[model samples]
Target: MGKSEAQTLLEKADKKANSSGGWFSSSTTKYEEAGDMYQQAGNAFKIDKLFKEAGDAFAREAECREKCKEVNEAANAWWNASKAYKRGYPDLAVQALSQTITALTRAGRFRQAADREKEIAQIHLQETNDLRKACESFERAADWYAQEDATATANACFKDAADLHADLEEYAIAIERYEQVADHSLTSNLTKYSVKDYWLKAGLCALALDVVTAKRNMGKYASQDVTFPSTREAKFINALVEACETGDVEAFTGAVVEFDQVTKLDNWKTNMLLKIKRGIQTESIL
Candidate 1:
């Protein structure tokens, strides 16, 4: 009902946690008691609506559990600490969540660890606007997810990483990520239909480099997916490549317009296409 009640619980917790028992009580028993005391204090703080104190209490409990080698329990405590701190202390929340991820990884809970990594990435993206940190977390999560055979989720993370890399103008890294996802997508029947989209994105990133690189990548993509060579997307890419090689800006514009007539290009695709168009024009001027 009040802070006084929670404060009383905290005092009792401190008393219990600090006491040294006789020979009958071992160090393990003492530490476990300390952990239980800390947990009770955390819950009491929560009941009194003292969120930061509650989070601090849970973090203490997590530390105690970690010393006792109760890894999973420590991970759970760390997660609780993160959740309690998320709104008011976002940086602390990310740190606590990072601890949770590390603990879960130590427990060999790869999927759970990957999930927490994604949460950290989202926190960076939505709460902090730290694009570089977000990209790194997503990339790490994707690798872990792939190791756990979560192909779909891994691809989603990879795509997010790729998008961020492209936004940062790291085109070579973006191309690698897009192609990696496409290569994996081709192995799953459910995802095979989406490989074309991934390859198209990879091709766009390559186009940012040069027409020769784009043509080489197109050939590689076609070899991986036989039907890819016959698709309208492939033809459209080919037309753009020829336009770039010959320095024909009108042909490039016509190719984009023709493709957009039947299939709507989203803002990203449209922007990338325009960027490549500009590169070709600059080359022609030289």
Candidate 2:
């Protein structure tokens, strides 16, 4: 019954939207009615668990609303479409959310756009397995949030982007992002304590490039935050850099093991350490 009703409403909406013969006959009313019909069709389809149909109906509604200059309403309809598509069509979901972001941006709702950016980023990360897209979305989200004066949220998004870049082995980009986060953290007393963590992450990425680069960046990290040099994280970074500099695989492994015993290394850290170890071994063979 619900599916039949939804299909009926969709047909009516399509006819209303497609009816021609305007010439100043005021087609705005027809568009507004068509939008209403589409919204009803979407709701009915959703009640019948026809997600794709629901999403399609909502997208049509959004288009009609946009035609009527109802920007916020159009954005809401696009958001609904994204949610409906998310259960089955992840790529379509991302596309719908992109529409939402565009509408919201045109409406000057930067914060909401930022929220949608993060949502789409997560879908890319967990559903699409597209880390590059996820990283770019996160960076875009950070820009939106920063423009909205949401400093902490922006920094967190940057950190997430940096982590994704690291996961993709794009160490230079990851290091830059980590440094951006650390630079932002340095300006706030509440966040100053976490600066060392970002610095440590940046150092690890630099170490992946080379020991000279790692040592140079670590120097910058210490200069940025005076207390960083005294932290155990800094000591570990120095030790790892030296191990890499000397082409000592055992020393690298020993340093990682010692660090893990203290701070409980995460998967990202472990993976990066493994890469560093391989580089050392490769160099030793040469």
Please give, for residues 1-286, the per-residue lDDT of candidate 2 as tens digits. 3449999999999999999837765677788899999999999999999999999999999999999999999999999999999988999999999999999999999999999999999999999999999999999999999999999999999999999998999999999999988888889899998998898899889988888889889888878778889998999999998888888878888888898898999988888888888888999999
Residue 79, candidate 2: Cα error in Å is 1.0
Q: How badly does each model clash, as a count of residue pairs?
A: 0, 0
Candidate maximizing lDDT: 2
For all predicted structures, in order, the TM-scores are 0.85, 0.93
**Model 1: residues with Cα > 4 Å off, grouped in runs:** 1-7, 21-24, 44-50, 246-262, 277-286
Q: Candidate 2: where is the Cα deviation over 4 Å?
A: 1-3, 20-25
Residue 54, candidate 2: C-alpha displacement in angstroms: 0.8
Q: How many angstroms is residue 39 displaced in model 2 relative to the true structure, after the best TM-score fit?
A: 1.1
Backbone clashes counted, model 1: 0
